[model samples]
Target: MPSFSHDPLSPKDAADVVIVGVAARGLAAAARRAGLRALVLDLFGDDDTRELALAAIPLRRIGAFAIDPADLYEQLAIHAGPDIPVVLGTGFEHQPEVVERLAARFRLVGNGPPTLAWTKEPLMLARLLHNLGIPHPQVFADHAPAGMRTLEKRIGGSGGWHVKPASESRGWGWYLQEELQGRTVSALFLGNGHKARLLAFSEQWCEPSEDAPYRYGGAAGPIRLDPSIEASIASALDAVVNAAGIVGLASADLMLTGDGWSLIEINPRPGASLDVFDHEPLPPLLRLHFEACRGELPDLALLTPEAAGMVRGAGVFYAPFSFEMRLDPLPDWVADRPPQGTRIETGEPICTLFAAGRDVREVRDTLARRRDQLWRDLSMASRKAAE
Candidate 1:
């Protein structure tokens, strides 16, 4: 049996809180530190991160948890816990039936009526953003936009899924016209309707894998967002937040153009880059999470982008190590000096290198240099082993 801690902090009162989809492990951890009785529930049971999950809850008062959403009813039936607050951290596609079944049982933050309605179709997200007046890339469906380059994208994809989903769903995929001419901006939104607040905003770049032509190479950080483009981006998303009645975190992808911004799509949950946002100590985003969990607005606002200049540069360096379609282990030299937020995955792409710098060039150069070093080390080691 797993050891349980019964310290005073555990949320003995089940009604106080709960969390779903263990992927939002960091947020859960923060909530626990704040004295919320949080527990993680996911389809996959405890693994190496379960300890991390437990730490996010009160020591002794940690509420009961279920392993999978499918097992939720069973788990709750057995524990007879309170109707705690639930935070959704899974992807847009993973929602659907799972959310519908549990909506009545628990209070789901950031999700309200119509939140999942528009997601049933592919281009609905883009349409919603456009209708809401947010600027984004020119969208093409069934045909390409006139006089511009276009890239295909899937309806409900995130991170690795971003490219793969588009490739597999070629015929039904939506096209993003390059001619729209705007920076690729992503926003993390919190709250409902007109009251929604923009938590974090940054640019994103998409890279394709060389070996797996359709597979995404992962994202690089700190895509430069022109200060002028914030208004267009904000206007577009506020409409969707109003329409959908979403309250938690919603990520919007937009393209800024001379004429206006075009809507790319919206992600209604915590995104992969959220960890990058956390490193900035932005108050609005942090305050939003706490406010949602506690049901009160934090008078504190996020630090201005200028104030966050101390840790100015940040980016994720995707592992490029591949051999005949298989991901290889990290070479000693590269693994030896792993950056602070570096993450390595087995049986997948090698790892993701996350680093920060004082400026864009500094950050980019640091990542480029580290990447080269990792490459050199790998080459030298291979030769030595071969000899």
Candidate 2:
């Protein structure tokens, strides 16, 4: 049996749960709600994550983009103790080898490294989908087929920034896929190796910049899906889970187009849409995630139905220019907050903004208004600080 510890201040001690991710806030919050003490290791140990977690350790950043995996392993070893159950989040899809190593060292609570490697490999996933009769974007593993509109994507990249035009000729670890025009949607689900239960469907939004046109911006859901469309998606999810042995929380990205839905990619861990879909009276998603991983899925009928009626949205507010943090009283809706006095570089995410309503459009509008308000407030404070 694995040992569990609740102490946060003692790094050498064990923890009940250890969550590693790029942004640990959502998972940490879910853990807290489940009455579990979690030690968080991530790139951004945001204020909320720190508060929710028993302890939060930031991974050593490699330049502006990635984290040092060696540092991550060192910190996990120091804080995780023996046989502690660890749950991985974002920032790991690209590091399957590291994930495999970590699994050998700790009791990883979600999908195994082998599953991650297979699902995250574009060519492999494309083949698997093809065999299952699951529709996915046409992939060109070597080069773009001449005269067809295609996007270049990097293996192990998340948040969509790693995607670009195939014509640009970016170096290795890249593949081309025929681009499709449609509404980007994500389905969040829980799997138990052989089957999956749907949780919510969300519309994915992107914020385009000259450097990253595909950069992820936000998500809104539980967007109503046509009955036929919903069934198709659910069937596809079940096929993938059965084929790949997917366990725990996972999300699939798809393009809803005139022809039909086409799979874009799969996030084989807890995803960004977590905050928007999770609600009260239902089990915390982390708890469900752990249960699913152990092959003990809850009665799908017991899961709350409120998520279907309520709408929620979350958006990342990027820093417009290099500036020192000066917004003193952070608003209630802001999350993933950097500490005051931290210098933020242009294009870096400042914080996440959230809003909820009875419908998707309402929540989306509220999120936009909140985002603009936060930007104005932060900008005003920066100007005053310079004076």
Candidate 3:
């Protein structure tokens, strides 16, 4: 077993920075490319992230720091020291009180208080976009009438939530929308102050599902846009940044509706397809994130024609036969090692697969193949165990 220690701050340490969630692709890759000696910390022991960290940095210098998000800063401060550069990779809502308390102690890099505050609700973000005249899907947090079809979403969540077809339900707020057959769009933004730039725009298809409205089955490469549409998106992005005074990673989900486009709410943090930028090179956004951390503004650049996409990476969980009584070891394949930065779970998200290709269709096809293969492997392993 790996020995765990709380004393992170040693004078002999060579790492210039400590990346909190190296399990995340963007964070790990950024730290790696920056050539910063990085130590990755996460609750579940991740061999993939550990291997990637070593590969990205020097094997001798790279280190792995595994701890729950709840114990993050204190552990780092105790062992890694107070001056280590820290970037948060966990959700903003997971431990709000702890984040607030540790705000002043570490050299933390992230969005401001308001940006974090606004993202707590879909309706609040929609109101901001609507008031600014940014084009977005018509969204209402209030109950839909008798005959309209709408998508109920968790205001504070992403990556799908329990989506019940509701003529009427309350408490869990959702993004109510009429089902439209177009494209689901996401554009990445980076900026400081009121001025911002569009980094990339990816057009995706939410796999048609009568059962899973909130779940996206797969996605495709970044859609190369006609100049006119790109311009409209750029103008709208600039307007949003100006209005919000936001300057980190922001993504807009839009739909190509008939002759015009409808805007979905903006995700204040990096979204599911952040790795798309990695497929094609877009260093400006990555640079901007670093700049923001340094309290410096980065130059804005227009997005090029390069495209990239992602298929929905799904997971299968094995629930205990009953309740908490069956505390067995996480099964073999579920506990199997994944590629670097591939997320894993013991009971919930067992495994995930990502694929990229020349176009959206190819990418979608590739993802489907990978997903199917993973399920087959897991099913076979399970059946063999039973036998």
What are the Cα lDDT values of the candidates? 0.50, 0.83, 0.53
Worst 10 contiguous positions by lDDT, candidate 2? 1-10
For all predicted structures, in order, the TM-scores are 0.68, 0.94, 0.73
TM match of model 3 to true structure? 0.73
Per-residue lDDT of 329 in model 3: 32
The digit string of per-residue lDDT tens for model 3 on 115-135 reads: 655544556667777787877
lDDT of 2 at 302: 21
Q: What is the per-residue lDDT of model 2 for residues 230-306, given as tens digits with 9 covering 90 to 100?
A: 88888899899999999999999999998588999998899898887667645688888988998866775322236
Which structure among the candidates has the greatest TM-score? 2
State the displacement of the C-alpha of residue 80, model 1, in Å, after optimal TM-score superposition: 9.0
Ranking by TM-score: 2, 3, 1
Write candidate 1's Cα lDDT for 1-387 as tens digits: 124565444433442456665344544544544555456654323232244354232111112222355455565444325456666665434346667766766666656436765632446655765576654455555556444566555445455333422212256533343344555656666655445566556646554554333343223343445556665455555667667655566676666666566666666666554645655455434346646434444443433556666433323344454312121355422211232223333223333345566654565566567667765654455445546
Off by over 4 Å in 3: 1-13, 21-26, 54-69, 73-82, 93-99, 138-142, 145-147, 162-164, 172-181, 205-212, 293-347, 381-387
Pitting candidate 1 against candidate 3, the one with the higher TM-score is 3
